[model samples]
Target: MDEDNWDKLDEEEDEEEGDFSEPETTTSTEPTSNDYMAGAILANGIIWLWLQSLQMFSGFTSRISPSILADFTAVTIVIAGFISSQQVAKRSERNQLIVALRSALYSWAGSLFMMLTSPNASITFSLILLVCLLAGGVLGSYMLIQMRINERKRKLQASS
Candidate 1:
């Protein structure tokens, strides 16, 4: 460009640069996994509490027998697994399937606790829940393996 145009452009650039905001600096650089886990747990707890409040308002729990409650508990555990999966997804796609599977295992353990506490609940139903839990775990593990394989291929391509 002409000398005058170049000078005008440089002046405009300097003016714009002077108007820019300064970047903030902090000491903490990385977020902890516990932070994500805490958020997930808090969200799930709030949802469960809401469900309980609904049950109270409708008198559903009182109308239903302990058997129904047991079933509801099982379903709640499954829902928790789903929430955990979502939390993992939010954190990162890598190893997400594995994290979700581990969460499913945690759900199974929670349901097992309820089953053990209830005297009238059948062992058979608990076994069925366990089977479903294991199935989800297996599927999650398979996905995790696939993710690992893809990651390896990516690394190989980058290196080559």
Candidate 2:
């Protein structure tokens, strides 16, 4: 019985050592294709919002009401967040980044909605929304670039 116990302990130690000896690789950390798609959608939405905001500021409000534009932007962001959250299989750095992007977008959307609905809305609130949107866009772009790089590394590792 003592000999069997010693053998089991040796086996466990060997397994632990083996686990530590493996090289760190992109395969373990790379985001799925769904993450890539979500990031792309977020980037495009940011661009769209920026253009719409610009149009509103440039005297195109005669065609579309600002309230309608704000509501559309909010809906777009909520849909993107829902789709991106659905794509996550497990918690990971990629998932965390997506969550952060979603949060930022949601905050911007809420600010826009409040500004449009409030009687005391001012230019300061609009400027804050613009800043948040720009910051979120930059963050989304960074995450997307990181995901692309990791994917390339994974492909190269597979081919080699």
RMSD for each model, in Å, please?
9.6, 12.7
Please report the TM-score between candidate 2 and the true structure. Answer: 0.33
lDDT string, candidate 1, 44-139, tens digits:
464357456756766656776778766666565455555554444444435555565555555555556655766666778667656555454455
Clashes of 2: 0
**Mind sharing the TM-score for model 1?**
0.41
**Stretches of candidate 1 above 4 Å error?**
1-35, 101-160
Clashing pairs in 1: none
The weakest ten consecutive residues by lDDT in model 2 span: 82-91
Q: In lDDT terms, which candidate is top?
A: 1
| Top candidate when judged by TM-score against the true structure | 1
**Model 2 misplaced stretches (Cα beyond 4 Å):** 1-114
C-alpha lDDT of residue 153 in model 1: 100
- lDDT per model, in order? 0.58, 0.56
TM per candidate comes to: 0.41, 0.33
